[model samples]
Target: MALGAHRIPPGKAWQDPAVVFAPSVLRLMERVTEEPHPDYVGLLSGHGASRPGRVELSARGRIFVGERRYPKGSPSPEPETFMTTAELAQKFRANSEGILAHECVEAILEALQGLEKVGDIRGLMRLL
Candidate 1:
């Protein structure tokens, strides 16, 4: 049975219905956003060549990738997950402000490659 399933006392409100979110998604979201209003975003795990898919910033700024059917570690392109992630390939948004994830990742790696680099979150944040 799924965690967080509504349990009943054989006659209680615990059986009202399953909560909207699965326990796992809730826990992962909590961990991912633990930085306190951190600049959060999404990335596609599977490549486009395998089958078109995408990850996007939901209106709530939560990372939503394809449908629930296409969740992480699940098999790719289950038909229900046929999505176009090309539009998202060159773009990433933070707090609804658009930016480029590829360029940002590149910049971060570049900064890390510097000879005088010190391992610091602030230093990395500057790359974005």
Candidate 2:
């Protein structure tokens, strides 16, 4: 569980090798699975009852949620009510900085936004 912490909150925990491989941490994970909360639903609620692509799991008392694709032909009820460009840009910046350098990320974003004007594909590759 700790090994994949980067995929969720407290995102950089995977970088610390000692913390991830600790015996105490492994014990905690084992205990959680063995004695999950009484009210834990641990259900994946998306698309429909028969076809749920997203999943949520509760261990001990912690709630862990993840999502991927929804079923085809089944759109979100409020599809038109989505994040604004500013919100998307904020999320992009947060996630991109984890792997790419800040300046390189900004450059790549700019290149993506201006792709139509680029005369050479190599220009985009250079930013990458």
Candidate 3:
């Protein structure tokens, strides 16, 4: 996001869903990785290549890295911005369907709506 935000084309690399695996981007990464490093190095992984991928960047000594995490079939061009509150709730409900009853999901949603009124977090944990 930061890279795309700073690019002359504001949505060039990070925002475009297709760019996640663009050959140019991968090539650039390969070039960077091939650069001579005297000490440790870093790598990038999880750029919509798999479900529940991680988004992180870290380096060791002379290397640098970047990574990304996004669920499969998730809309792009700012996927996080595409979900509505109700849609998020629906997703939550769907994911919890087998582990939690519909009633429990509804109760949890309601409790979250007025979370400030919750007196005890244990009360909510019990539901889970």
The sequence of per-residue lDDT tens digits that candidate 3 reaches over residues 26-107 is: 5655543233322212321323332332333343555344433334236654466366778778767866766788899999
Measured on C-alpha atoms, candidate 3 has an lDDT of: 0.56
Candidate 1: RMSD to truth: 17.5
What TM-score, over all chains together, does every model reach? 0.19, 0.45, 0.39
Question: Which pairs clash inside model 3?
Answer: 53-69
In model 3, the runs with Cα more than 4 Å from the true position are 1-80
> lDDT at 78 for candidate 3?
45
What lDDT would each prediction earn against the true structure? Answer: 0.42, 0.57, 0.56
lDDT of 1 by residue, 11-113 (tens): 2222334442656545645544212122122323334323223334444667554324243334565664443443232222222133446567656556655
User: Which residue segments of model 2 deviate by more than 4 Å?
Assistant: 1-19, 22-24, 34-99
Worst 10 residues of 3 by lDDT: 37-46
Error of 3 at 78 (Å): 4.7
Instruction: Summarize candidate 2's per-residue lDDT along 41-91 as a digit string, tens digits.
Output: 433332232233444577689977765433323444544435565655666
lDDT score, candidate 1, position 45: 32
RMSD of each: 17.5, 7.2, 14.3
Per TM-score, the best of the predicted structures is 2
Candidates sorted by lDDT, descending order?
2, 3, 1
